[model samples]
Target: MSKTEVNIIDPSILEDLCNNVTDGKPVNFELPNHGILHIDKLLPFICVYRYSELDFYFARVIKTQASYIIVDDNTDISHLLEGIRLIMSAKFETFLVLECWPISSEDYTTFEIFCPAGKAPSTVKALEKGFKSLNETYPNIAVEVNDTHARYPDQLEPLLNVEESKKTGTLVIGLGIPTLYKNSKTNELYALFFREFYSVFSETIKRAIHEFIRVQTTDDFENYLMFGKTNIDEITLTSDAELAEISEGMSFLLRTTPVNSNEEWTNFKKNEFKKTPEFKYRLISLDSEIEKRKLYNIPIDKVDDPTIAFILRGKRLEIEKQLTMLEERGTKNFRFVGESLYGVIKKNVLEEAKHILAVYPKREERKSKERFNCHEFAAHAQKELDYYNTKFPNLDLTLEIRNDVAGIMVSKSKLLINNEINLDANRCDALIQHEVGTHILTYCNGKRQPLQQMYEGFEGYDQLQEGLAVIAEYLVGGLTVNRLRLLAGRVIAVESMVNGATFIRTFNLLRKEYGFSDRISYYISMRVYRGGGLTKDAVYLAGLIDLMAYLKAGGNLENLYTGKFNITHIELIEELLYRKVLKQPELPRFLERESVKERFKKLRNGIDITELVN
Candidate 1:
């Protein structure tokens, strides 16, 4: 057939060939007139083949459907077909079949190629002849071909094996070309040709076809011949430049495959998280811990984030369980002992011992006060404490105005305050009711419990204590903007320290930028940066913020006093109380006041007490 009469099918047509062939069978054949083709039905049915340069150039069919394709020819046909035939043929298939085949020396000598199928000698010879022909025909086209296997010793084995074909080749050659074919029927013949030629002129045809595809540009071929799809636009086909551009575009597209967008990627990650079983348990554990703590009067630590609260709940559960057990067992023991005959006798004796112990009032253990500049205020605070203590004898209370910090707690001995702070008439009265009335009351009440730990503290006790203290101050109208600012400053300083900024840097920033006084700035910075990065300052602001949120959410003030950091624990406690699973602990000595108005007045107008007391 004339060269013009010879039709080269589009590369895509190979897929059709692969699907049609191996209608389910392993076929092996050789076309001495063509080359070799082999088909094996492995999962996708792999095929291997090689074709002589003459067979490849003159033969009519080139498409197949087998899973892989291996072209073997020694004429640079890659440029002629724009390399589309090789890539497109391999795109759909799992592999590409290759072998080295050659054209007659007398015909041409300008295609240089390499053989990866262990036929380097034959491949080199064919390439030398082909390059000479190509130099003669297209001298302006710069072509340089090297036998890389021989040049790079490390690459030799990898290039020859079909498995390493993808990584080793200058152009990764796939195996079993027919498997990549668009048409299965075409693959049967193609596979036969591949097996037959390799089994026959194995090394020669393998090298020859390799060289042919190497030099051929798909741009020169008709669109229908290269891709099996016809272009209706004759205008697009009219120019060599247009065809070249189209070929280049297609090649670029094949090389760079598009990836999924970010949103899709995020969705994939989220879905993966959902599939994890731990996610469910985390939620349940957090909820359960919160509920249990609320029942036991233990409080959650003041944490801003709900996630952090969840984490702390886990950490505190053990301590809370111990406290609960102590309460349950101790209460039962007290009740049992009281009911026994010997218990009643011993109780009376114990009471006599307590009365003897209480005969002389216990002296305050905190620093003793002297006649200072603010003697009037100190004396007033002392008198108020004595009166409150008398009114509520159950409370263990003492008032001492010294160089102690602001804010009060029923420490083991004293209601302390910094004498340095101006404790005017109004301030002294406020401190008496807020501190002596509320804090002392709570301490005494908690101490009355069979378990001493109730008077002590639990894991999340800080949040409850701080929240209630602030609420007490608010109810008493003593909470000030200055106090709020101090809290905010603490949070800011703590965050800065955590971020690795120095104490000097924080102090300077707050003093100059925030316009805080040197005293305030130094105190705030020191609070956070003290003793190798104390993170305590963060608690004040974090606590106040949480307290506000809880109160705004309509949380009950009395319930806040009940304690427990776990939200679920609080919920459970509330439920239990509703069903009487637990009773509210009585207001401690510090909380009790004859009148709400009087208590409110004291907390509101309470002393300019240094924040340290709380």
Candidate 2:
């Protein structure tokens, strides 16, 4: 809510604000000028900044859960702050007033903490240390602490007298910032530098606030991360939706997968394993440059919450790389971009894949009398969807049988099945757990989240997603030795493709060295060599290995089910969940099975990826 343009803050407005603070309600209102007073909660501190024409971006970078007052010097914010101190001090028993002002110093320092002489030494030391932490992230931005003797800086009048601070039990620290994100010559904003500064500096402010609260207040804080903003604004949500829409417009896997897999395999077999087959890709849906421009224009800078800003910005970069990779498909540059996106096959992962292949010889897939057709598998998938729908009515997932798709693949909320597919009864249940239990389950769970990106899949989400799917197959007693060999063979195939091996050579390596049949070798080669040496197939075994280690170290499988995210995102997701910005996700229904629970117990206690080769 905002007020009409006024020369000063109205008395009645102050009264309403005081009442709200006293009653412990959220307070957000705009002042006469372009000033804003936003109090996320009635915390013990407030970050104050006097609005200036030159330093417009300063207020935008201050991110914290603590309340703040941003108004021009023309507005009388002294009375407004006095009212706040009276109520806030009475409520919390102690309050902190962190006031900020611009400095004209041309030194190398970016921030200076000014404190009154003969004041709380411990509080000053904590605040000083907090600002100093910024040096680790940005070593050149020097920060210093000084004793000003006076409560206010030289450029501004005192908001509270020293005696007033003692009486109200409030400690005031003045921050002298250089406004470095502005161009000195043209006086224009340096947008990129400002964004980078905002992402780092805002977290620094929170760390400083956390220090002050610990040294001065009665609250026992655990970590500075808890002080982050829990509320996501409308701008953040809108930007996420816009980006998700753009992401949905393109399918990375479909565009990258070879459309002529069957034809290519037929040609390769007819040539007696002497020739490399040509591959084809799907038509691009969106122009690469136009989509990249749209991604960069999403105004992610307007998002003040530092965590959300960091997430969105990183996602935009990932999407840009993906677009470039798609545009560079069928070229040498495609492999380089793919490596940057999905990462290259590591030495250890390749060694592990080779060891697994050497130890576990290729075995024939057990034949079954009853091989379920596409219609029967679709029926089983529908039953699994129905089970989840019973628990969550909003889980409306679709199962489609299409001729274009090869085998089973879960894309977004829909599960696509190839029309010519016939699943052996022995492996049918495991495939169900892999697709319906893991992929579709995570997608539906992500849909329940407020952030659209969670459902769309986070950057590098494919690794963890496939890892969990493979684990699901094992948990349901469907992880056959043949399946394990196939996963390992894919890794070897990717490593060979990355090492400049020809397709026919890689196929022969798999067939002669690993004992894979001609058909299996052709299939693996087709997947790895599709779209100019894709490296994503390597993640299946690598992710399973890493995920098993994570579980062995006591990481929660339930956390992995929160959404489609990389293993690296576990800590960030925990932070968001703690801050209440993200809700606790629902676990998959398969976890309720007695056998699956036993499997999880074994996994948590001690289970290696090699142990799952049953």
Candidate 3:
């Protein structure tokens, strides 16, 4: 129903209630939220004190209380919902927007009108409150009823006449339920709800959002979700089994023990070999993996879908590159920098490193007793795992001490810790947030996806993965000046290796010029020269710079959190979702955390980490 359908029996009542809103004094309406919504000098301005309750958006609600519409100073709706994190049921796109007038509760009386269309349990309670106000003040409710619900009673009531019973003659049409539109402030809920609908939602929500869109807003939120669907049961042109096999196959082939035995490397360092250290690495089943990939034989030309072809071919390329990296792992002039092009530190990265180096030359240390042992880190990892598993009860997590990685996320369900090193308690939380919070979280979310490559990672994924890991550090407040300097040092190390600088040269640069401790310099140099000029470490700082720019531009981190997505892959991920090729990422806890929203806001407004240290 449009405004023309509304018949306000007592126009003076609504006007009188609205008029009660005073400039000198404002009326407060409590939300089912964490804070109060203050309506003062009603119509143009409303303040949501503790507005963080709804999400991250900090705003003054806009004009036209009758419509509950909010707009920026320029009336642009874009900024209103930008970066808003709405927490809602994943079932539907339809939700209610609360609007409280200055009218006293004493003047309100409640009664129900049968509104079958608006009868969803999620919305009816709020409807009841608004109805009570309307019934007490006005003789007839001013509601915009959709054509379907209006016709529903017409069809049912007449059919009842066919029964010719006493009950059939007694009929009361339930209409006049007011239609509510989410103004700019509340409008973000629709965008967020739609994202949930697909990432995703249940049937009731779809219907509710569709009905709500038709009855309330002038926009087409429902049709937009439908997105040219010919029918409801749409399926994509891809095979889950095929993708899963390829993912499993590559992971199987990628296995290997550490390149140089830890003992031999310890001796090499102890010998003070004033040259590049040499070691050996071998792929366990190189031939078998090659045979399997050949059998998968990606037929790009035969593939009807470009996305399927691209993903398959990309996986094949990565497989071949990974094989080469493994085969060439420890030799003189050996460059096993897997996907090194994506890891290049650019001019901006160099500039940022210079800034970081200038700011954090002095190393910070925690007291020895404050250092947490391996068991303590395990406790922390377990707690972080518990936090994750609590959020998603189905995730079966396994914790194990492994020598292969310092702290590696093996898969959606497995975590590998070095077990040899004690951790600083101060750094443990950030590590958990980095390893478990980001890697494990994204892995689990990817597992929930229909596409297996989500967890496995696609081409160009390394940059964003490490970038997000570093950003997760910043968001969780674990990124200290020393940590920032460490990342900067990695960029410097990788740069030195890229330019064929010797390990000794890189070590000395970090130790003397950068003022890094010999231990720290040795560690950074070893990582960069691990495979004789591995440029992969460059991604940590370079990716941080790129991801920072992305965040500053209001890119939703939740999308990246959905899977092991590269920044470049965001569009592809969206397209895959649009074509039903991939499922929406399941757990985007990073975006959902209230603790990080303010940080994101600060980042969006622009921040400089190097400035903090000095």
Candidate 4:
């Protein structure tokens, strides 16, 4: 490890390190808890010196996560080691500190409280108040709360791990929380409140002793939410053009390992679901697909990039799952797909939709009707395709009408419109933008990159793809109230299926309670129940939620427009662009149109779905 990794600063080596090293470079240190800290620069924050032998560096936290932190410092060696102790003493095992800062003499003491941004203000006040009240009672042990600084540490995993450890009954220091632990050993919910102080004097000890005697209950544990930050596993990054090759070779497995897309499955399930059903069906055996999948097994163990390896592994697993389901339809199909897509709806997401459905009233149909037959609709859709041609002269897009597809973008170059379904005139504009502007545009943009996965997309790409498509409807002033309700109803119906509700039950729930038309309800319910419980329909609303949050969080829509991507890849995609590993999007000039720009602003500014239609 480099010198910057440790938080310890010895005045003896301070000048030596400063003179030997240039500013704005990374320094590393080995932490006792098996962690590494990479200080980007010793950013001249603050310094404390005592006795010719002792010194300190204070680092301002810039970006904090669970297990690592990137700190900026002008210079320090030992101060980083000290910071490591500070982090671990808060009950984290290992962490990385990237950058540096710190302080004075005259017997000054520092008490730092690390908490989430939302809780920082309150935590500071509460800690100060608790100390002040203690000081008022015992004047001899009184100390002023002098300085407070908010920091962003890159490593948050260890701190979060500390919370999990508390499930057993461990007392953590530096973290200001009165934990009410459920004592598993005693088979009871027991709360143990501990106030720990690692101060220089005995005053902190007296306070800790007093608080230690306080037997906290499970009720008090809920109030401690203010003391910690929410943490997620860190996203590992790599710049391996090799991933493009590996992904390309593996892509063939997906085509052969397709899920049930036959209209018969939908019709039969909808028809049979009129009764309590244990419906079964025969599928062409997946013997060939399974053998091919095995032959093209992902070399996950050998992939150098952990992130890429993980993603490839998931893709391979999904392919295998889909292949297995083809051989075993019904509950087996439902089980495999649900497990593959992680289709199990969480309680919170389910409740959120229920709330929307309560107030999301349906709308009268737009003046435009599905009056055009198949050939006429194909001719009409061609007009929209012509409009796109003028904008993307080199896009090489093809449009064809088919019985199987309902306006699906195929092979990133072809748009297939279902010839059997009537075309809704009002929705043609929305479908044009959804299919041509959003889907085809992303496919074209992704084609500019070396990675075909960008164009073809990775697993779980449907959520982002469909979300952007649906949002396009809203952007173009065609997101009818009925359409938005349909999206919401899908979520409700999906939740019902996951909860073991049958097709007919979900259909009635939508038609009777939500007032959807019989045909609309039947189709929506069919979507959820098809192929032994496909949860893909739920992605419409879930993807919308994710996209909305991304926009609100200052995410650039251009990143998403660049390819078939997941919200989780935003950072990596941007990083790739920054490193020239990925190319910037080549969007059509129509995006710059004033009307589209206005729509972009509306999307960027934010939207409330329930009120959006009105």
Candidate 5:
């Protein structure tokens, strides 16, 4: 009947795919020994791959999984074709089968397009346009266009019946890519470059598919981003969990903060601020190499979902940086790694900090008649936790007043307080909201999310989280000029340290030049100089500046509460929430306050950082 003898695959496989697609459900499963078939929804196209000699290279390149089919042998090819027809019958008026293969070319990297003779010319042009446009990103890669009677790879008969395909509203295009990811002579893969190329190449295909859908089909979607995999696989989930496990085992901040902070400050001052203080950090019991090895063991490459893989890969790089910083602590390399991780203090940030130190008068500092000790503050913090527990019920938080910890900090889900901490009774509520309301609140929100990395803290999450915490202080009507000055002083101190200023020199800059009191100056210098000079303190002021601008532009505060992520992640976070991949988070407790509501209204209407001072 047809030129190519059609081999009928097992009917059960076709039945499973067709039934799920017809019912408007996702299909993800192995086609027995054929290969994997995953469809996020009823998209109008399918990216198909049949096993070949360049299996390793091609398998890694075709990343569009919204609707895809991969198979091994002749029987598997039959299954793939049948499955494509089944999907077309169940869901679409017009369909596209984008089959890709790898060609062994020792000369150079090129993409060759093979369009079947009968398809619309516009459709063929769209495919050629997509391949040609890759020149913008990969200028060295050449693109060639050709017409073919059969749209299939080498040594394989046409997988689809041409006459029947036309009647069924199906079109097929064959793409041949030279194996540029491997050494033509040795056949060894350039793994890192291949990964980068894979991401770009995948986007190219989606761009082509986007144009194809616009010209050929009436399928409705916003953009090529909709082609990204909506469903994360078991490999992605487990890999994320394993990386989070390694991150949780190492508390970078806690391990890096000097254990003998008070002693070092006292000795430094006792030495009349001449010699640099040697800060003693908490000894990491776990071997750094072993921990780094654990990070390496994560199978991030096995993850097929592009979005999730990108996020996970970023986290792994950050973890590796932290581990290296830990191993290099107390050495010259420590500060270099720290600068790379936290970022160097920018000129604008330094200018802003200097302006705050100059403009904010010392007279604006709050005058309090009563001061409370750590015990009183701990009691107040526990009461605040009690209030949140009523809302969340199982909100688990611990308050530990440790001798080693300086000031108040939230680590993991625990609020750590310095045993010798003294606070103005007036500012207690502000401190409570900053530590518990923001840090612990977001951590709790992250726990409810599907990704464990959210709870542990996504890479670069500190900036947004700290910025939101400072906003909490302002909302509770406790943000004071003195507190603003304190935050600004930290930025100045970090800038000095990054500029090669010694501890004693930075101490004098804060004390003598900036008019900071001895106690305030000592603490600021210690924090910046700790772990051989950290630039992290600058984020508080930097985050606040960026957040003020974000709010000025009408950014949503409720979205920041979704989980611990950087401001850069807003779009991706929103996309995930839109796809129902991430659960929508409830507003934080502080947002419920009438005072907070009034304050937020002003914030939304564009309030300046200086204007936020209570």
Candidate 6:
């Protein structure tokens, strides 16, 4: 018979045939290829059928047999038995079939089919055609038939609703009826049967679809059923599957080792804190020492603060003697002689000159115009200095012009000018009010006290000195954005050089990009970057920010000027001033308020008056 030729018998007829033939006797089915009968009882003569567009086949017994039957066919028997048991009510031990195909050698096929007593042939036809039609629609599928006797009806009910299974199983039985053709050649019959079998079974061909559905549905079902149950302490009903998943998640958490405890978190923060650099200066300790020694007549110990020690050691005895003599001379009035103060002016003169020369080197040997211009500017600066000195005589001031230097300070005899004037108008005013008004006033005030250290200096004084000076410029309206930008540029230039830029790079950038004249740019960059990683440029901007904060808090600029006037001194002065215990100095004879204001106005405006005054 051809492979496509299917025998679609009514399941009821097949069941009746089995009952009549068994009759408590053995039956044997003849095999076309001389195959042996493996069963002896008639009850074992169960029919195995596969229905599909690809191939169709059936096995039958002519006499009573044992518990099983063997058929030679070279086809899948398990799939055939599953489909048969699903439709028919027949019971036998087992059925084995051998199948031969053109592509390979002969192979044995085995199937087990079980059915109840009243199996109808129409039920078989329905199942066979249903599966075959499913394969026709979805070619890569295989049908597995099983007896649903012991299982609940609901199990098979869901499958019946599946359109593929119902339609294909029905089509396979109806379409496979041509296999009984006797005129057909054996090869033609084999091909026809095989083709029908494959078409019907194609619905169950690939396992991937069933596997994927099983995985996804099982997970969702488990989650839906087990969610709250897993958390119930008393239940203890977790499946090994759920426990295994939980264990894997916990293993991942352990591998990551996240910090959870409060102490562990705290330790992490503490470690980060330890990495920060400690502050170099502490205000409390320095203030305490200063306060402790304030009442004593003896000189402050030099080791207490190096900067203070340097200042006191510079002119301690002379300043002390001058102050004592003035107190004794009953010198309620005194006029400053600018020239007499030149001795002290000389101390910083060479340092300032070196700084200037470092910044502006002579390009040509003789009488350079830049050098001459610098000198003319200095001469002009001196005139203003002299004017301040002469005009502020009520404040015991004297004005004198000299070729020496251009910074000022109050001496027993006069307010000194360094005679060297920085032709830069902004720098000149900053120097005047900063050094003269604050430093000079503080000096004369210290002279009133028994201890000379008050006037000499304070520890960590540079920040205070520069800050006060810059702040004074702001008060006198000399502070300019250009000046601040210059300070900021110095910081940037220094940082660049520290990071390994060369002097030429620093100089060129400042001159070209920053618009600084070559002379000024070279000096400023050199001052910051030349001294082997010095970070001094950072202080100006830092000091200005600090001073602005101090002033904003309603700080008295005049008192800050008269206070010991050191960056180091401000904290204590602030305390004293806050407590209202701050003392003022006795008025000097020649320092007139109106004259000082006039001089300040000229100095503030950058007017050169030295030649005109002299």
The lDDT of model 5 is 0.78
- lDDT tens digits by residue: candidate 1, 1-614: 43223323344533433553425333333323344333333221222334433334222222222222333332222332223233344433322233322333332323334334543444345534433333332333222354343321221223233344444233332221112111233422333333332222222232343443434323232211121111111221222222222222222111211122223324434664222111000111123244343433333222211222233344344343432322332133322321221112223323322232233123212232332335565577677567656645766567565543423334533666545554323334445555554555545544543223334433344445554555565554455444445555665665566566766688776666655666566656644443234444445444544555565566655654443333334553343344222346545343454554454444444433222122
lDDT by residue (394-417, candidate 4, tens digit) is 777778776544334455667776
Regions of candidate 4 where Cα sits further than 4 Å from its true position? 1-296, 305-307, 383-396, 406-411, 588-590
User: Residue 204 lDDT in model 4?
Assistant: 28
TM-score of each: 0.34, 0.89, 0.58, 0.55, 0.86, 0.31
Model 6: residues >4 Å from true position, as ranges? 1-431, 497-501, 529-533, 563-569, 575-582, 585-614
The TM-score leader among the candidates is 2
Q: Report the C-alpha displacement of residue 217, candidate 6, in angstroms.
A: 90
What is the Å distance of residue 328 in model 3 from its true position? 3.2
- Which parts of model 5 have CA positions greater than 4 angstroms off? 1-8, 18-28, 32-34, 76-94, 108-110, 113-137, 142-150, 166-169, 207-220, 263-278, 361-363, 367-376, 387-395, 553-556, 592-608
266-310 in candidate 6: lDDT tens per residue?
A: 443466422211111111112223322331223422112222223
- Better model by TM-score, 1 or 3? 3
User: Which lDDT tens digits does candidate 5 get at residues 406-427?
Assistant: 8998886789998898889999
Candidate 3 lDDT, tens digit per residue, 204-225?
A: 2223334444553344443322
lDDT of 1 at 573: 36
Q: Lowest lDDT 10-mer window, candidate 6?
A: 224-233
Candidate ranking under lDDT, highest first, comes to: 2, 5, 3, 4, 1, 6
Model 3 residue 507 distance off true place after TM-score fit, in angstroms: 2.4
Error of 3 at 379 (Å): 1.0
